[model samples]
Target: MKPSLRPSLPLLLAAAVMLSLAMGLRQSLGLFMAPATRDLGIAVAEFTFAIAVQNLGWGLLQPFAGAAASRWGFRPVLLAGVLSYLAGLAVMALAQGGFSLLVGAGLLIGIGLACTGSGMALAVAARPVPAALRSSALGIVSAAGSVGALLAAPIGQVLAEGWGWRAGVWGFLLLGLAMIPAAWIAGRVDRVPIPALAPGESPRMAVALGRAMSHTPFLVMAGAYFVCGLQLVFLTTHLPSYLALCEQDPMLSAKALGMIGGFNVLGSLFFGWAGGRWNKGALLGGIYLVRSLVLGLYFAWAPTEASTMVFAAIMGFLWLGVAPLVSGLVVEMFGLRFQAMIQGLAFMSHQFGSFLGAFGGGVLFDLNGDYVLAWKLGVGMGLVAGAVQVAYALRGAAPPAAERPAAA
Candidate 1:
């Protein structure tokens, strides 16, 4: 890496724009699942299974993709990722059977998302920023993802309602296509010098994967991330339906979800900034603790439309706020040379949680008449996650006599 060069502001903007589009389009896929299942003759679990496959596949592929990008190049991997993303959209739009849905939406799109999602965005952020500013830059990239969700949720709803779900899929396809130029802008306009591993540096991918897997702090943090995913995705995917059952309009439900995504941008940026300035683990613990309290309070209050909206806004502020700091911790402990691979490994835990959250929530709702138990379980998990992350922070600290080298 050239110590003299700085990542231009335009490059940052370009990266953020591309990331936003990719995130918005991918996230909007869930909005179509329930409606599509009803229109097609597929079972609810079948649709849920497709999404679960998507998450599992993405998680599985992310590390490899990061490795490839690390070894070969970012531009080619990014192009390939875009193709996979678009192909997934196309197949989903035309799918006539479960096979098509699984292949298109589940395998292909999942792999595509792995290559292009937060892992890649963080990598991009790491490349340009000064070491001291890494956490803030990472947060900015993460906030871009939330911005996509903030916009995409409501837009997806409108397109699905007005133009048809298929049209919405196609619209997202067009959006994905637009990412090509942004990628070009953000990536190699010239043959940039490749970053080199330090002298005595281990092979990048192996070290990252092995180090993260072996580390106790990483394990605890990653495990807690799993719980966060379970709670967040479960609620996001099904909250609209839950609200509707409580006599709220579907549009209102969509708005609530959108609001969650919207406020999350602020939360993500806030936590990201805080991570740079303060103890990230403490901040993360506090956020999770607040989440647990909020969930319990919402349950007790018994949601009316006004109260539900208020609760949503509160929950929204905390929702996905953990992302930047969680990823930030990986960089803090491991450094950014192998950041993508390390982060991807942690993300696998996240996806596993998402799989359980998405599918399990559906199963629970189908089995029982109420989601009360699920909500309660979510609160419990939040507390546990908070404790785990706090423990990780304390345990991961360097030896008292040792000082960390500054990142250049």
Candidate 2:
């Protein structure tokens, strides 16, 4: 029997909203770092490490969180995630010392994000959309996250300026609380139940999962995403500070971040559409190449507001575009049997990259007094990732025999 394609509008809307809020808030955390560090009298590295831990935690928890959602359903996981996120925000807000800040920002927020953030949301969203429209749904969800970044940066700056960093954190907590309703609504969408097999089913869930992990194409894609995570998270988390080092105006930093978010919508939509028509892995590989070229040009060219904005826009266009393609590739390779779980597992690699990106940038900058070295490394890795992806695509895929329906 064909699985039903239609899903309730309310469910889609809720997924989009929660996805937006979770992504945007997480992206905006970079804006808080400078001020938070200043107010708490902590080293920039310390805060960077905290944020690194958050990225690591988010990555590490994705597979398990996705599994939990898959097993118990998306609603419970979302609720738990949101509650944990709010508590983390509160912890950061009330923190009077470095240790408190570390616990809240590093550990608590990290785990909270793992549960409530994009990895889990995308999994839920994937369930409702038709197989053909899956890429587009992912684009919409990823774009929502970018929109969050667009809204969060300026708002965070304003709130921090007026009431202070503590108060600003409180604002994030309230917004997180508001997201609970969205999560609840997302849960209301009726799932197309996976019917129990009669006497024999294809393989057990565990066996299928293990097979996917060992799949060559999946591994290659996962590895490429790791590089993407490294570049993107590091840039978003540290770009504002890097701009500050260049002696640019503070508002310029926020505007740059907002510009990245704004342009990312176009990037994501473009790639998502392209993923349907093109060889996804090849398309993704090309994107990484473009990123490398853009970064190299930016570093070589003289720095000016115009140059920075233009570079930001170009980079933004390539930014989250990779997301839909990566997720789509997973569905293509494995079928959506355990999509969220598999995608989450892949995302762990990306998040691990994020951990390196966030913390390594800080460590490198502190040791070298410049971001030059980190930029160079990112360019090189981008090239390597592109090459790796193209190689994976050339290997090709075969249809699963299990996909044929059983005789009555």
Candidate 3:
């Protein structure tokens, strides 16, 4: 069957809004680490452990959420995520100790992210557009997803500074409420028809999983994705604390985070456009390479406000650009029937790295009294991942099995 030429504007807009809010608020959680830890007498490692748990939970449950969306519909999963998000923030706002923080910020928020984050949102965005336009569509949605951070980080910082950490969480709760409507709207993608299976393709999710797992390129991309999650999560979970330890003005972390969000928009769009015209695997590799170099340089210098902002801009541009490329690659390799689930599998690897990034960074800092070692590990792994990805892509990896013409 021919794919639809016209995209669904409402579905795309709704998905973008949902992704923006979900990611924006979650990323801003780092801002709370300093105040929440000091006021509640929780240690930094404990705090980051909660974040690590959040990433792990999100990673572990993501495939299930994606499968549920495949079997039931996107709406139910999305609504559940919004509710979980609100509950998590509420628990966080009212928390008096570590256990509540773990339950609220760690587990509940993890569940919410599994449902509402890039995997589900990008899958929704991919559905309405034709294959020709899919990459750019995913990019536009991914770009909009960055907008939430632009607003959320500054607002959370102001509220936390003025009122308390609780106030910042309460603000996040209010923002999360908007996701309900957005999810409902984006769920309209359920009405769009799935593309017919490619020749020799099986409709069963298990078969799709088997094929993707066996595919060499998919494995390579997913492995490199581990580095992607590690690098980003380290920054989001620790940058605020790192800055505080340096005695820089408290607001600089927020500003730097906001800058990353701003640049993420440009990066997502540029890569989205580029993915359409270039080898997505190579593009993914390039992003990883540049991002690693930027990270190394930034950490090598003693950070000033100017240098910090510049680093954030460059890193931000290189940030979520991976979302479009990764999502596009999954679709090209596997049909949309299980895009969410297969992508979820890759993201699980990313989140495991995220778990290490958040928790491991905290452990390293607690033990060593600084982040020098953590940054070094991240940069080294990222370089290897990028190189492998580039070499594989340049070798002209096979096209999607579904798209390949059959033998006579």
Candidate 4:
């Protein structure tokens, strides 16, 4: 294969760095929920709803951003994403009310994620790489975000407490802006393989999405990933509150979260490398299965600082581990032409789940004085998600493209 058959070093680095910055910054948002809300006199439900809005916005906008990237190159769209992210962060730093937080943390941040985070980053990074190396490449990129999380989480908490949550907002804003130089690197190419199409046989993104939606396997996969989002968001958004409820040291939540980020780096890399040697979908199923068990154990034992750290380390290793597999599934079935669009559609499910996780945790905690129900539900969902993936893998058939439409 020629050199162009693979992603260039700079392209991969740029995408990885952007993803790291975006994800790490976004994950740190949870740390601010408690402090910011208390200071602003915002209700937990209201604030959680604001965070949920970000997840919802991210899901809904990802497909559009991806489709736009498919038609235009990734650079302009990515630049737009950069601007949106910076604007959102700026608003957050200055915000003292719910409405401003809604605009900053909810809407603009979601738009930024749609453009610069997983959906577009994965597409740009993988599309330029050879099939065999794509999984490893995707893993490396995903793991980069974990590294960001490792560094950003503790720092975010410190900033939030020290400068008030507003200062933490400023810190994340600066980190998000760092993606600009990376965008310049990743923007150099937006190559998508185009096969010969018969006259009047154009392959539109809508058609691809329609095909994916109509497929049972794809639907099942999406449903499974919804649980993934829910599990993650619940932990990320509400862990601080949960700790406070249990009368544990407040710093412990930050420490656990930071550990999760640190271990997640290892998990992403391991999963990425493992996908090359194992069945991708099967690996995803296994990952979810382990998640269910881990969460069950977490709930079984009383919460302790040491136990929390242990759980975080274990969970972190599995965090975002399925990203490459699930994303790879889309590319495997549909090829690279519709990579961004189809993958975005799939991630939509993840973000929707995230919304439920973040908002639901707050609602449940507010109503019941604890997070027992949320944790139980997450465990059940994880089991279901695992079974769904396994079943889909066993029933593997050709993706909708080769069967009914022009090669995408």
User: Candidate 2 on 52-146: residue-level lDDT in tens?
Assistant: 88889888888888777767787888888888777888898988767888788878888888877767766666666766677777787777667
Instruction: Give the candidate number with the greatest lDDT.
Output: 3
Candidate 1 yields a Cα-based lDDT of 0.74
Task: Give the lDDT ranking, best first.
Answer: 3, 4, 2, 1
lDDT minimum window of 10 residues, candidate 2: 399-408
By TM-score, the candidates rank as: 3, 4, 2, 1
TM-scores of all models? 0.90, 0.92, 0.97, 0.94
lDDT of 1 by residue, 176-247 (tens): 787787777666622444345444445546755666687777787788878777877776667766766677
Model 1 sits at a Cα RMSD from the real structure of 3.1
- Residue lDDT tens for model 4, 1-408: 443434367788898888888888888788888888888889888788888999999998988998998788899999899899899999988887999988999899989999998888888878667666878888888888677887778888888778788888888887777889888778876654554553443477776677778977777778888888999888888888877878898789889988998888888889988987877887888888898899989876678999999999999998978887777777766667777888888889999999999999889988998889989999998998898788778776556646333322
- Looking at model 4, report the run of 10 residues with the lowest lDDT sum: 399-408
> Model 1 compared with the native: what TM-score?
0.90
- TM-score, candidate 4, is 0.94
Task: Count clashes in each candidate, considering only residues at least 3 apart in sequence or on different chains.
Answer: 0, 1, 0, 0
Model 2 TM: 0.92
| Model 1 ranges off by over 4 Å | 1-7, 189-200, 299-302, 399-408
lDDT: the better of candidates 2 and 3: 3
Prediction 2 global C-alpha lDDT: 0.78
For each candidate, what is the lDDT? 0.74, 0.78, 0.93, 0.83
